[model samples]
Target: MTDFDTDVPPDATPHVCEHCGRPFARERYLALHRGLDHAAALSDDERAAYETAHDAETDDLRRFRLLALAGVVALYFGFLLTYAVVT
Candidate 1:
């Protein structure tokens, strides 16, 4: 099977950070997370990856919020229309 197979566990211990609860398969990830979150000492590649992931997550949340707002507005407008028709 390929390395990305979900059934296979990674070689390193599954250590999760106390601050973020982010699971890391390698000890190096703890250092990386500490540097990025607490120390602001991320390498260029680490910074780039973090920024990219953050942007994607932010975009997803924004889209979900917008959709939820739209649904609420539509429901409110529908209620108003029904009330107006009935009265």
Candidate 2:
């Protein structure tokens, strides 16, 4: 293999930061990094992309929390029902 190939890992991130040269597995991560670490240096397009990614991540987190809450509620009711039947 070539020297360049040896430097990169087999599962290296495909998305790379333009300013800092950091690698990310996804474009969203790179956008977030750029926005947080290099905010003043970002162009209009980059800033927009970062906003979109941040919004998406926020929405996803909200959904996850809702799902977890629903799961806990369901388990609590199920256990109560089981105890009622046994007693």
Residue lDDT tens for model 2, 1-75: 122222345566467776766666777888998999999999999999999999999999999999999999999
Off by over 4 Å in 1: 1-36
Worst 10 residues of 1 by lDDT: 1-10
Give the TM-scores of the predictions, in the order they appear.
Answer: 0.57, 0.81
Error of 1 at 79 (Å): 0.6
lDDT of 1 by residue, 1-87 (tens): 122222225675665656656666655555556556755656676666666656666788899999999999999999999999999
lDDT of 2 at 2: 20
Lowest lDDT block of 10, candidate 2 = 1-10
